[model samples]
Target: MDDSVRALRAQYGGTLPGPVEALPAPHRRDLAAVLDQARSRQQRELQESTDASLAALPKPLRALIRKALGL
Candidate 1:
């Protein structure tokens, strides 16, 4: 993450990025909405991967999971 930040700063000719809080209300809201959508998509992908892994397990292991989950 630090390397990515450094790369971003270098890409922008060493200028520091402004804080998100410094933006106007509308801009901040837009940024928040985009971030929320991105987070939701990422969470969905992670959940799907977990579900796929669980489905691939043997029945007894899967039953233990369902019992633990109260499903």
Candidate 2:
């Protein structure tokens, strides 16, 4: 399978819509790149929020929270 197909399927929980899967490879690759970037940005924002929310706690408790949540 094309890497673009693989990336897109992974994003969609292991399935791609038929129309998307039928797109030319170049278009699929472009779509995958755009999605990957958007996912990355969202992840970064979430991480920042998680860190900020935990910042007020004492060090040991923060460590415990991070470990408990696998953050």
Predicted model with the maximum TM-score: 2
Task: Write candidate 2's Cα lDDT for 1-71 as tens digits.
Answer: 88999989998787899999999999999999999899999999999999998998888899899989997
Candidate 1 local lDDT, 7-45, one digit each (tens): 344444565457743566566556556756777799999
TM, every model: 0.60, 0.75
lDDT of each: 0.66, 0.93
Clashing pairs in 2: none
Return model 1's CA RMSD, one decimal.
Answer: 9.8
Give me the displacement of residue 53 in model 1, in angstroms. Answer: 0.5
What's the distance in Å from true for residue 45, model 1? 0.9
Over 4 Å off, model 1: 1-18, 66-71
Whole-model alpha-carbon lDDT for candidate 1: 0.66
